[model samples]
Target: MYYFFLDDKMLPVPPPKMEVKVNNKNKTVNLINEGEINIIKSPGLTEVSFEVMMPNEFYPFALYDNGVSNFITRLSGQQPTITYAKNYIDGFEKLKTGNNPFRLIIARFNQKFEYLSDTNMLVTLEEYNVGESSEYGFDWQVPMRFKQYRPYATKELEITTNENGEQVARVKQTRPTTKEVPKAYKVAANMTLWEACRRASGGSLDWKAVAELNGIRDNNVLKGTVLNLK
Candidate 1:
């Protein structure tokens, strides 16, 4: 069994008695002989679709009333309503202001009707359809589609000063630190000091530093000459 809770008040409606489908959109890449690789992309939104039955008691007059009053009231006012249709319509309108998305709680049950996993989803309504009456009552099937709304997580960095008055990077989280190691490179024909330093230092060290360290007064050096890079 699954349950969906709309806005803050938990609304008085019971959980839908239908299957809820969840879809996750992800990016994938295919490499020959390597199968498909899932790329680390942004926290993509999710799409959910389900059917809901709204009883007559829970239905608001605004949904069935045929007039421009409902539209004007919902569009130019902040008043709250108990009607499910008005709540959803108002909630969607509020999404344009960049406010917090609506909350959807999904509760699952096992064969014994025991509690299973309870997942909380923050989403915005994307689409909805009102089905035709198949039974003889006010109850109607409302198909709803929602999209997940979540911002991407970003890495935070901390900058601090060391005892020697030198600035150092102090990460708040555990991360891999890259250490530059000294290397040796042989000068090749038609290669300048800048080019040699760039190749030996991985394009990080300056050419002046390399020339000074090697005691090379002339920028031009003979081929086959080896220089120490630190």
Candidate 2:
């Protein structure tokens, strides 16, 4: 038996059948002489397709009163739902906008109904399908699809600094900064004050200082204007 939960609340009706697909994308180069060359392989997206069944007995009171069609409307609406499973180990929060990514855990069940191997995935809901429905005592079928969502992790670097004349390794979040100070630079086409400072200083200069130095009231900088970088 498969169990589904939305956040802490388990879905009243669990779909009878659920399909999970893992996709991998690879880059190939084709030449006239050579047949093909594999350049790189990308961590592809994972998709979960399932049909939701809404029965009058299992549906919420609101849905049952308003009609089973409301169930499809709710799923198709902008609201997000965090889904997980009881027997299956994997779960994820469905989001409507932005980087709607979440960790997913899938657990295997044996003949005795005990969960065995577990697989974790990071994914997002890509799209969904609302198929034909039957109104025989209020029964509906809704299909959904989920894709993979991956975000780059930030890395920290430790630097040895002299604190109180003692060398110590300090760890800090690294951001782009300028190092070398330039005397002046002509504002190029499509150049912003922020970009100018970044180019003048290796990576340690701030854009605010540049703006203050140039007396720039607005962010827009005219092209071919030479500004002092001191």
Candidate 3:
């Protein structure tokens, strides 16, 4: 048996096919007095793509982890209608909107369901395809792409006293002490600073404080702007 999970949430039905692409960052060049040689560089992000099945009807082969949520439409105090397809779609939407990296785990097992090995990594959901298909009947097929996530530091200027007792400032980079958010956030188009902070912190961060720290008078920031969270 095998299990697939994104951010600890198990997929309802295992995809019929799963493909993982380990990207290459190597460069080929001609060196001085040498023929064409490969400039072997570090590996690129590992990409995983697969089409997950969402069963509209319950089948013995289908697995359900906890319950599905109706995230898109909900009146004031009403709960969402639980459906397998909607649950998976809700998870995907959260991943795309959260702007965070989560752990993806693929576990292997024997017929008895004993643990074997696991393919585990930190990944960010890149994109996903959603539409109705005749082949799916009343069910749904969602194709998703996830890329390995590597963290980076946020650059900031630090003031320090030199040996001559003179105050000096220097640029430094460091990760965020708080675990809830990233070291820095890259602003996307039509992205508000408030929304970014809210998503990054999982509602744990105060947007006003974050904006004050970044000296952002405008909540509507430009695209590609790196917001320092330190």
Candidate 4:
């Protein structure tokens, strides 16, 4: 048999290669389609993510040609990069103040819905009646663009140095005094325990707790007993 120059079968086969061209001006990534669409939307998902580029190790032909020919370069790293600038969001600075309001805008095609809340947390619920065709579905998978007022919670605080000369941080929890109590010595005459408790503690101190604390029973007040106001 004629001898071959070298065992060609012993040589390693070349692997496929790919190149990427990123357009920073448009914030778009272009890559060869391997049956994977870059755009994704899911109703059952809470978070969304996608790979803009693969690692150099995963590239089979990356080492070929001494790792220089047909090499991939990140667009951001390229000189004279093409980058686009977008306007800052409106009311972002104003939202930092407590006066800013919350807005929830949802759009499905042309349909739109918006909700406003003064608080940071929001609760939404939907229900379907058992007899009404039993059709109910929820999709929390969509990405939400939230514009929050800066400083969700704030209070005017006064701080003083401790004995060790260390600064101390204090938080105050204050809500509107919704309920009013009877002023000192304003306990209604011939009132029941419930009535007295209602008046004495601004209707805030639990009636049961008040009764237990002051030895009152039910709605009945002790007759002819002087109330000791502390």
Task: Find the candidate with the highest lDDT and give its number.
Answer: 3
lDDT of 4 by residue, 138-174 (tens): 1011111222222345676768789999988777767
Ten-residue region with minimum lDDT total, candidate 2: 80-89
> On residues 119-163, what C-alpha lDDT tens digit does candidate 3 reach at each position?
878899999988688987989888899999998766789999999
In the range 1-230, model 2's lDDT, one tens digit per residue, is: 34442222233455667787777687888989989998767667767777665443343322221112234435445222222222212222234344556544333446654435544556665654444445634454556576666666666667675757766765576565435577888865333454455446633565667778889865445456787877
Ranking by TM-score: 3, 2, 1, 4
What's the true lDDT of residue 114 in model 4?
17
Backbone clashes, each candidate: 0, 13, 0, 6
Model 2, C-alpha of 228: deviation from truth (Å) = 67
Model 2 ranges off by over 4 Å: 58-94, 97-99, 103-105, 129-132, 153-230
- Assess each prediction's global lDDT (C-alpha) against the native: 0.55, 0.51, 0.71, 0.29
State in Å the error of residue 24, model 2.
2.7
Better of 3 and 4 by TM-score: 3
Q: Give the lDDT of residue 161 in candidate 3.
A: 100
Candidate 2 TM-score, true structure as reference: 0.45
